[model samples]
Target chain A: MKLLRNLFVIIFLFAVFVPFGNAEEKRVRWKLAMTWGPTLHPFVDTVENMADMVETMSGGNFVIRIDASNIHKSPFGVFDMVKLGQYEMGHTASYYWKGKDMSFLPLTTMPFGMTTPEQYAWFYYGGGMELMQKAYEKNGMLSFPGGNTGNQMGGWFRKEINSLDDLKGLKMRIPGFAGQVLAKLGVTVTNIPPGELYTSLERGTIDALEWVGPGMDINMGFHKIAPYYYTGWHEPATELQFLVNKKAYDKLPEKYKEILKVAMKTAAYDMYIQNYHMSANAWSTMKEKYPNIKVKTFPDEVLNAMKTSYNELLSKYKKENALFKEIMESKEAYLKKARDWTYISDYLYLKSMSDTE
Target chain B: MKLLRNLFVIIFLFAVFVPFGNAEEKRVRWKLAMTWGPTLHPFVDTVENMADMVETMSGGNFVIRIDASNIHKSPFGVFDMVKLGQYEMGHTASYYWKGKDMSFLPLTTMPFGMTTPEQYAWFYYGGGMELMQKAYEKNGMLSFPGGNTGNQMGGWFRKEINSLDDLKGLKMRIPGFAGQVLAKLGVTVTNIPPGELYTSLERGTIDALEWVGPGMDINMGFHKIAPYYYTGWHEPATELQFLVNKKAYDKLPEKYKEILKVAMKTAAYDMYIQNYHMSANAWSTMKEKYPNIKVKTFPDEVLNAMKTSYNELLSKYKKENALFKEIMESKEAYLKKARDWTYISDYLYLKSMSDTE
Candidate 1:
């Protein structure tokens, strides 16, 4: 009986402490493939956080071994790597995969689809997530909102865009449906990486550019070269998405999946606040740091044109992209509900306050 | 000599096996006070992340021991605690400290103050931080944007507010300047701790409540009882702030202060995203899960009245509060920049887009 008791004690210790209890506990390794780098603050912040969250929650059962040392060439290959299971997960925006399916674009930004709050509402509850999941079905991934820029800065310009004619023949950096509208206005538009904007703008290679608001733009000092900083029309709300290969997501234990969702949500929300908070201070800093810079707005005629183009793009996407149609269908319903409340609540309240003075 | 060699050999083995490098790592620990609980999501997220960032940056020499578990109480207490050195650090908003000085309210929110992004720019770069710090000088605290909900939901209502008269005699839950404006509309407004709002609302304690936008209000399940969710005007550009004890912050090595600033910036941006992301889904969830809940907008007349009140409140604050004057002067310059951008950018962009095709 004494020998048996001693043996039992030894077995129990091994069961509880060794090999992390089971197959699940041993994964303290994260092998991540990247399309972007550490400078992509929001994405990097979230990915780094997720790795820590997963490790702490799993009690060393699972760990993400990020390949930060040699990040990938571009995000373009990240999807395939995630799908092929070279890494456990991947990060990038759904809109970046427009070539795979235009439906992904509506899941992202249009000319004026939804603000950060509205977009989150439409995607999470308005069946947008289901649609997003379905769209990614072909790619073998389930996606989440990884980062949000809240509302974006319109664009930076060398010359004041006081009229539609200002866009004519002037080279500007822009993208998505807004680029389509700019094309209509006869603007020479280009799509380039944000890192390259400084030299391009400095060399007079480009007349204007837009990037993720102040948190980043201020860091790069884009305002230094672009004296005419304008608002209204290019990009209103840009949401960054983190795409997980569906197979890997399915492989996640239910608990880890929950952790991932919570972590992603936390990261996404937090990034928006940081950008906003920084933007407020940076606005003042930019002026003091770069006195030559002028914060300008796009002209009335240009905005009108941009809005019309926004509708045109929406209609076009609805007709051509199944995902856009579904999203818009649900979005329109949600929007109406939101606007209904706005009319009486926000609209009425503001008007009343303004009139009181 | 042989004894010494043996000891060195043993020490080398210990160092090689246990991350026990020869270089001793010095660690400094400090307590942090916050207004919310550990499970408050965003704060937790920020703490978790900021901890990682600070530790890594400091080579693990600096560590923050969070006292969130016991520190959270009426937000009203956190600031004073910081000022009194009851805690080493803290997280709260400027508006919560209005009792300290009404001028401090401008550091948080003004009538139709800058939007989340714009406010961030102004605070960081627009010389707003220097002024804000000046406001905080008397409190033994320094402040910055810690978090933001972006543009908030107007409010929840028991009855429709269609005209200026409708607000008369209506009891409201408002704080800061917006509340004063509600008073101007002949409304018998009241203020209460947010934790107690549900009790007050359920007991028919207040005619209506203004908390946050749909993203937040829906979470509190306000729509379930209050069928009418009004939009716009209650608090247009409400922002959250971070209050750091002056002595504590001053004592922090400049490196620690930078971490605090970076952490706050990250949190502020993240908060904006959280509202939109969660609210996006929450809105649809409310509508779908609670189909009976109705969303409506305030009438134009009511909005006009609110705006009038907002302007009037602005003027009143300017006249009655020195801090208000300081903020208003700085804000006037910022708003002029914003207003000009609004005319050319947002206004025109909408117009142009509407006219296109």
Candidate 2:
């Protein structure tokens, strides 16, 4: 009876404490919500990639399940849900939360702001990341760069934008801050649902609309209806963001936390490259099929007017929010030095290549 | 006695089988050789970052010990060491092996190839990875992009290049294929050890030299002596490589393989951003301290001559190596469409901004 009792004690200790001692055996399950629908490429792919990496790196011990907007049924409410800890994290653009806080606007991108690589450098090495954390700390959430859309195209236009007069009273589906900037330029800016954008352009209900770059815009069939595609000035490096509930993040084991952070960072950079490839391919196909499609940049007069309005709006926001003022000032300072490097390196290189051609 | 014997058998099975069932308990140790010295910034940082991520993700079960050139005493010998399985892997550039094979040349960067983002897109999505693997299959190694140096400056010249005559018989310390192209244009190209480069340039042993971008070159004090800083035409996207022994990689557990790959990828992208930030800060400092530094682009007459010589050299190699031809053709095809996208997106945006300025 004594031998049997000793054997039973040994088995119990082995079954309970042995697994507990090994961190890899500790299982953690998490849920992530995304503002994008299930079918959105690159965005959905970014979430899936991050989750897969976390699961694999943890050896199946840590798993993240993603919920698309269709499943969550609250695309714009992602910020509130993640803040309330209803989900461990959420993937969405920071600009979407501008109504709740003006500081969230410039966190995404700005008109005539840093390009993709420039913005990435600012985020990782410049004071941008600290500023971002300061903006989110009050909400009990940590925010990170989710993914980048590279440089977005201006818009697809039915008529060529020749001058400032061309933009006056123009009916366009331009959203957010850009809409306000355009409105000040005498453009009739209006918001339209994504589904209605294509038909609106086709029927001349809206004379123009700005979507994403060629990658996401190709699917909307906007190029078919609108022959003029304008080059981008607004949203130069539109970065989506990941919002993490502070409590949930704090509870993760040290190793799991590193795993999750690495996974998110890798997935974010991968999405940028993935979208670059997609746009290159999509634009090539679009150009081959629609040879008449004209690529245009807004005339200097209109661009100058747009810039003035953008500055005026920025001044208004700066006066209203101190945090917004701090963030923009940091960005402007970084941009001055970073853009000089860009000019000598990538910009001049491209200019030289084009000159020879 | 029967009960005791059964107990012994159960304990033996539990101790042996439980650890085997848990993949996390499997230990992996790897040795990596780096072509760079220990003090090299961003390059050495990339290798350390990858190893650190792998160790953390594996919960310390997987470890990679890195030996830099100083410890290994063979900077250029990394390829052979990794290929022969003397080291499990190496961090080096593919173009260093151009002496043994011509196909290895373009794998790093070409004279007028794609920029950093474009090259990354090609590697991951535009069939460049497949071509790279095919190039290394015979060597019993696998190649992955280790990091990018972004766009390298043309060189620091003591005199501005105004015409084709300016380059004729100019003694420059430019190496590899770019040297051959310059040689064709009547330039006397020489190779000087890195430690001796600064003195050589200052003493006029070499009229000009290209090291890397401002991030790496600022430390070399070349700008202090040379006033003419030309924009990059060669090595637009210089990508370093991670060379892995196939047998060692194949021995890794499936989950470990994924972790290793994800770590390598994240580290590579991080290095590019890091270098960008470094260059931005370094250049800003250098410019302020030395306001006399002049940034110039080679004249059209000289650029056109370099292009002709570059094409001739490429044609010579293409005829000699079938693999080189195949790889270059694929790049040219991808560049045609990719450059179109780059022009309308980033290039035009930068151009417009500069025009306004």
Candidate 3:
């Protein structure tokens, strides 16, 4: 009886302490490939941040390996790498795959796009994310906001684009839907990765390259060769997404998903935070580096012309793809409501300050 | 005679180019005030952010004068008057003055505290002005993130607090500092005016309070309610500053003294930005809607007993203030350094994530 009682006590203790018993029992190693190099684009910095968060939050249970930049291959390969199971997770522009489905552009960025907070509201709470994830399912991946860039400056280029005439046959490096619109206008559109952009521009390979914005471009050394800066024509409300193979993500326990979600969330905002720092530094440095590097805005005619082109591009997609049309229509409807409030909230306040006080 | 002809031609061109007649004269008018009820606080906010900025930037062509706070008899004067000052100017804490400063707190927040970036960096770069000026400041005053709000919690209480024992004292209504920390300790601190504090605590109206961390405490609110909440004790860091006296501000030429330096500048980091919206709402609604509230931190015995007390109360400050002292040695040394990096690069990057890709 004494031995049996002792055995029973031991069994109870084991049951009580089982969950906290071992450290190595639950650890999982993850390889997270990031396109952000050491210190260049804000998006890359954000990827590094997410990798760090994943390790810490999981109490070192999960470790992500970020291969910053396309050290292995190319940044555009991010989507397929994860899909083909070459990588567990990777980051890429959603619209880059617009060829898969043009509706993907809205999922990435809208021209003259949704404000950051508004996009957050639509994605997280307003059922927009659910729709996006549904769309990504076709490609064998899962998606999250990853991050929302506040807004972007136009872009930097080599020459002054004063009018419609300037855009003609311009061998511009642009991607996605905006590139499609430029193609419609008589500009020769070329899509090249950031890695090759410098040499191409220097060798007169491309007339202009519409990269992220001032900060990333400046770091890319684009200011040295392509001094003419213009805003984005292809991806405006650009959103960089992290793609995880659906099969791989499904195999993980619920806990891993939570960590990934939180890590991804952290990465999303960090991109904007990094961009804020990079942009300020770039603005100051750009002028000092090049005397003739001029910064100018596109004329109203140009802005209006692009807006009209955007309408045509979007309309064609809507006619063919029911999903693209639905998301766009819904996004527009929600924007109408939000924008109305913004007039009272943001615009008028500025106007009143400019006028009254 | 030939040299004299050349000089005459130069003089002719100078006269033609000067064009004082076509200088296109410009004028602006504005009014502002501070929250200190007609004292130097109000004067400082109005003068610096508003009147001073205008006069200096405009080269003294404009002039503005802000009436004192209580002269207008507004304890929450900035809140009511700022909308009127929208085109005018007024000043208050983003958190304290939050009934109105709610939309502005992201500029301030004490969780990690307002770094110079959020204080000035975000304000100037992050569309903070459009949000802050148009929404809160424009209620009457065009706003400026006048100063810093390093990092602070709450004040002290009379009772010997140990865990739940901390909250036994009754009637704590305060804003700014000690509210969140002590409340987490189960102490219910509330926002009480400086005038009403002495009367309330003496009449057994309250238990404890927190003012402006350590530096401003002795003179502001803590000194009066002394006997607890040790100096350099409860709140190790708390940032403060003023808003513009808009009317007095807008009337200035342009470019003058107190240009309200860059919020990220080493000096401007001393200004305040904002905190949580819940803080102000709590202040306005606490006792009137909820409990009369007793608030306090743990006793020295209990504080020492608390696991993180020393680190929370002192150690981190030792490192930061050391750096601060190296850069600035006024004892408020830590605050300057605190604002410079704590929020933006240090705390923000440490705590926040950046990318999806």
Candidate 4:
């Protein structure tokens, strides 16, 4: 009778605790590749923040190992690595994969597209995530917004661009769709590695170049060579992306999955805020030190021509690809309404403040 | 011998799994109070989202139940409820407790302050959070940005103000610091419950009233009666807040603490984006139904007088409270640099786009 009782006690304890305990502590280890080097501000910080949140939330049961481009030795290969499960995840921009699929281009940002908050509203609430998923589903990956650079400066120019003719035969380093648009306006567009960009511009090999905004640009010393800083037109609200292997993501325990998702979402927003701070501080310092640097906008004639070129290119894409058309239409419809709100809310408020000052 | 073996196996299993499993599954239940009623989205939505994320991320072991103002019967009592630990947390705006403590006012926002993205940058990356904590620490609580309403509209006015003289003796229903500013400018500022606002405006009891922007205002049908919607000068980025009892927060398990923090952060940002979407859609609908509604900015003379009045009120607060002075200085310094960036980035971008269109 005693032996039977002991057996019953042991069985009950095992049934009650062991399986549930093991499940809760189930370990998940993932490796993430990045398109950027390790030292990149805000970008690398975002990945680390996401990983740290996951580890802490999961009680150290889940860990993500991050590999920057130095270790991966393939900056642009992040998409393939994540898709093929060579890495469980990756941090990169969707626009870099435009050559692989035309639908992937607008997933980042377009020339004269919606600003950061407007784009975020579109992404999360205005049927953007669904369209984004459709773009990545064929690649066997899940993509999420990683971080946002609020706006990219049009570029650094040696001289102000006053008219469309000023762009004619101007040697510049601008990439992606904007490069194609500028090419139509007779600007000589070339792609130069970021490391050589400074020397290229200084040596008159290039007249101007579009890098990121002041936050990322100050460090590159672009302002030293190009005195005229044009405000953003191309790549407004450049959102970086996180790509996860669908199968690997599917394999996560439900709790860890939720943790990863929440962490990623928080990290992405944090990066936007972080970069905003960085840009403000950096621009302040840059302005104090380089008061001679000029801020210019492309004149109406040039701006109008660029807009026409953008519309033409967009029309071509809409005709060429159905998914591209679907995504563009969604964005255009959302942009119309969202921009109106933006105008009445923040824009008017800002304009009034400026006017009063 | 068999009995001994069974006992040994049971003992080993108990030693290995029971303690660990029990720790992982330890149930924690908490309650949160909110200043809003059940239907006041995205405020209520923010709370629900946080609770849902907490429940999911903690694997259902930790749960937070939310009680809206209707349940608690104390919308303004949330600060005290959270401070005294009647609830583990509360969702409310910081400025609601201005009568209790002057320092709590600037934590929410200021007249002519930073916009949403700019304020978010200050809160997360700049010194706003630390100062916010300093303000709450004395009350035995911790405060976090709960959500943002972006930029708010000034008010719905029956007639336009052409100059500072036009504002004199204007009967308006505008609350808080903004009301004080207007009152100083010789306006008759009154406070009325939200339910009676439309009727009061219609009955000529008040010539103007400020509610939230189009998102929260469309339901009130104010535009139908007051066709002149003024642009915002006050409460540019009205951030809601989450208050946690220090003791309750300290008592949480480390993993649960991380889960709660991450969940709150994500939910706050999500609410901001959600509201952006809501306002966009709402504004579109409002415009379609009421084509006669016009957006207007106050005349320079009127705006300049309001700014002078705002500065005077702020200076008085600074004299009365050291903490208020400290927070205001920090915000002022941050706003100076951040607004500069905003001008070059989103402001300039929006301006150029509008100009071109």
Candidate 5:
């Protein structure tokens, strides 16, 4: 009887404790590829912040290591790598995949679409996440908002753009859809590597380039060369995306999954605020250091022409792709309601203050 | 020798597994009190969302139960309850505790202050959090951003306030420091419960009342009675706060602590976006249903007077409290930087689009 009692105790301990041991000992190590290079502030910071949060929350049981474009050697190839499970996850913008899937174009931002708060509202509560998931799931990947750059600057220009004529034959490095929009306006639009951009602008290989805003643009030394810094019109509220392989994500334990999701979200929001802070600091620095740098808005003629070109490009995509049309319509419908609120809320409030000040 | 080996196995098992069992089985249950009632949409939702995330992220081991004002019977007592450790946490606005500490007034919102994004940037990246911690730590509690109401509307008014004369002798229900500002302008400022607001406005007991913007005010039925909905100046970004007992927070395990903090952050941001969505939806509904509801901004004379009154009130607070003066100076400096970025980025972008559209 004594022997039997000891045996029963052994069985109970083994049954209860073995699973706990397994849970504790199991470690998840994930590699993430990034579109940006290692030195990109706020952008690189977002990925690192998410990874750090995951490690801390999961008590180092789940770790995500990030590889920038320099290490990966293919910045634009992140989506494909994540899709094929070459990297478990990737940090890039959804709009980068427009050539592969037209529906992905407006996921990042539209020319005159919703602002940051409105876009977030649309994503979380206004059926955007469903559409985003539907678009990504077909590629065997899940996508999430990685971060927001708030509103991007229009670009750094060597000369002020006064009219549509001023844009004619101008060599500018503007990427993706915005490039296409400017392309229709008789401008020479080119895409260059980030490292070569400063030299390209300085040597007059490119007369203008639109990188991110002051937070990011300050490090590139663009302000020294391009005195005419135009305000944003192309990618207002540019949101970066995190793409994860569906199989890899599905395999995570429930606790780890929740931790990863929450971390990514918190990191995304944090990046937006951080970028805002950085931009404020950078702008203040620029003003103090480069007093001659002029901030200008495009003339009415140029802005109107760009708008027409944007609408034309959008229409062509809408006719060519059903999902593109569906997504644009969803965004357009939401933007209408959301913008009305924005106008009444933030817009008017800011205007009132500005007028008084 | 065989008996000794069996005894050794039992000891090893006990050493490894007993602590694991205790860690897995020990559940921490906490109660949170809220100043708002259970039915408040995004406010209540923020608490529920935080609790839900905590439960999920902790794998049901850490749970938070929320008590609304109806149950807690102490809308204004949340600060004391959290400080005394009577509740593990409390969800309320920091401005509610202004009587206890003058510095708490500006933490929520100030007249003609930063908007949502600007305020959040200030809070997270511009040393607002450090200042907030300094204020709350003295009370034996920790405070975090609970949610933001976006840009609140000025008020629902029955008559147009074209000048200072129109505002004078006006019976209004604008609460907090804003009410004091209006009181200085000869307005009869009254405090009415949320339930009595519509009735009070309808019967001519109050001529104007500032509630939360369209999102929250929709359910209050204020728009039907008051045709003139004015844009906000006071309480431009009304941020709610979550208060945690310092001792209770210190006792949490590392993983649980991280989970709670992240969950709170995510919930706070989510609520802002959710409220934005709600406001957009409600505004659309209100416009369609109540076409007569005119969106107005106070004239320059009234706005200028209100601004002067607000500055005077702030000057008094600054003279009385050194911490209040310090916090106000910090906010003012950050706002100067952040608003410059805001004007160049979102403001310019929105203006450009509005002009073209």
Candidate 6:
């Protein structure tokens, strides 16, 4: 009888310990959807880097398979799909969903908004993250900064814009809130599909166009055709977004969760650096090989007009939505203080060096 | 007989799986020594953040204990301690080790170096990491950027500096390579203990002093005594470093290695943002409470002289050390290209906005 009792106790211990051990070794598979196609540099690279970190950090026990727009067949559907748990997570820009929710527009960027470092400060250290959570809470999704493209170029123009008269009646391939602001300035703003942008600009179907900065823009061959590459105005610091279904996120193990969060954060910052490198290299190549690609800033008259239109549009949105109002006010207040430090620090430093030159 | 055979098989399986599971579950404890004291905000917070991320990502299997300067009793001894494996890691500035090796100087920041974003691009993307690893390989240690204080304030001054003559025979409490450059320009440079800096400046023993920016300088209460706050010229992007014992790092489990790297990267970026937030808040507080503080830039004549002095010192070091020459040339070339982008992007944006204001 004692021998039998000992056998039973041993069996119970084995049953208890064996499953616990297996749990640690269990393999978890997740799927991610990205708004960009697989061919996009830095953007696609950011998603891949995050998954790589997650896999290596989790020892292959947790894996995330990414589906780009080519596979997913719906770039704009990412937020809804993640919300519905169709995919565990997504990489896309928040402003892309403005058609569904107008308040989601400014999360990506704002005209004359905070610069990259300033926006990052606001996101992580200021109340930007909390406000973002609040914005997405009702949608059953979680959002984080996926990556940044730094300051995007204003656009490619066949002719230089030296006055407000030069902007009026201009047909430009620009999109989103910036498009609206441009349209208000009498620009015949039209959205051309990405593949058609270069052809349209070349063929004069669109007189001007705005893509990303030189890093992503070099391939479009726009610099060869349009010599006037203006500095950015509409989007100062365009940050991409990472969307995760709250239910999917909640189901993750604590270790996996931390790994995912850290991986995402690091990957976001990495993309910014990577793009900086690409832009620098591309700019160097362009400057040496294509000397005609003139870099210009919109004259003060045109810029001030654009700013006025931007403010008016922002005011309209603020009046319509309380949350939008709150978010904008927060950004304005933070920018006022942060920009002062920026002016006294980086701005002055650059100014001093340039002055000497 | 059959039941006994089955029990033997089960016992063998348990032996194999249990050890494997335990290996993954094994707890790793590491000790880190920081150059800053426990009270240093954002700097100390950066170390804690990295450790916290490591713990959570490894599910408490990897833990790091941080010892501040107060506990370690040796602020400058961190590099040696980590090298000797007395501590597995350290948080300090790279320039602190210039006494041991002059090549270690520019890794922190040059007299007029890249800004935070520009320096980060050089570090992560533009071959800086490879060069750093090569430099530190002889010491059996690895280093990474721990945090950034962004552009430090040039210094606080009791009187304005309007010309090259203003700097002549001026006693200033400044340290490191910047002080070396300043001393060359006929300024009487002195290094005072941090606790006595305020008193020294108040008693006219020091005419000017450079500490960290508004984020850290607020605590020292220097603004009350020194009315002239000059913008940064030296140490544009002062990056603190994390030093790790290589053999100890190599021995870590693959999972822990990824966790540690990702944690360090995230924490480093976080510190930059956190400091940005702190500086913004502190500057606002200072401006509101202390209306007498005047922000100034050194006159063009003085700046030009300083630049000349800086170039001479750098050239002297470059001729002495091949690696230092290689690193500085690399920085100069990269900065030339990157600064063009910066001028067109953030600089123009700020210039336009300020013009309107």
Best candidate, DockQ-wise?
2
Q: Which of candidates 1 and 3 reaches a greater DockQ?
A: 1
Candidate 2 backbone collisions, by pair: none
DockQ of each: 0.13, 0.69, 0.01, 0.65, 0.63, 0.64
Which predicted model would earn the best lDDT? Answer: 2
Model 2 spans with C-alpha error above 4 angstroms: A3-7, B8-17
Candidate 4 — which residues are off by over 4 angstroms? A2-21, B1-21
For model 6, the superposed segments whose C-alpha errors exceed 4 Å read: A1-23, B2-13
By the lDDT metric, which is better: model 3 or model 4? 4
Tens digits of per-residue lDDT, candidate 3, A49-118, equal: 7776666544455777877664765666777788888888887667777777876778877875565544
DockQ, 0 to 1 scale, candidate 4: 0.65
Model 2 chain A: weakest 10-residue lDDT segment is A15-24
* True-vs-predicted CA distance for residue B162, candidate 1, Å: 13
Ten residues in sequence with the least summed lDDT for candidate 3 chain B: B348-357
lDDT of 4 by residue, B1-357 (tens): 677667766776666666655666668899999999999988899999999999999889999999999999999999999989899999999999999889999999899999988899999888899999999998899999999998999999999888888888999999999999999999999999989999999999999999889989999999999999999999899999999999999988899989999999999899889999999999999999999999999988888888999999988999999999999999999999999999998888898999999
Worst 10 residues of 5 chain B by lDDT: B17-26
What does candidate 1's lDDT look like per residue over A1-357, in tens digits? 556555545654554454334333334454776567766665577677766655554444567766542466656777677778787677767777777677777666666545555566566555777887888877777777776776566777877877777778989888766677788778788988767889999998988877766656787767877887765455555777777767677776654564456556656665654555555446656767788876555566666777776677778878988766886787667665544333333334434434443
**lDDT tens digits, residues A312-334, model 4?**
99999999999999999999999
TM-score of each: 0.61, 0.98, 0.52, 0.97, 0.97, 0.97
- In candidate 1, how many Å is residue B116 off? 7.0
Candidate 3 lDDT at B110 equals 34
Clashes of 5: 0
CAPRI verdict (incorrect, acceptable, medium, high) for model 5: medium
Off by over 4 Å in 3: A2-17, A20-25, A35-40, A69-71, A84-86, A192-196, A199-205, A225-227, A232-234, A251-253, A288-293, A347-357, B1-94, B97-357
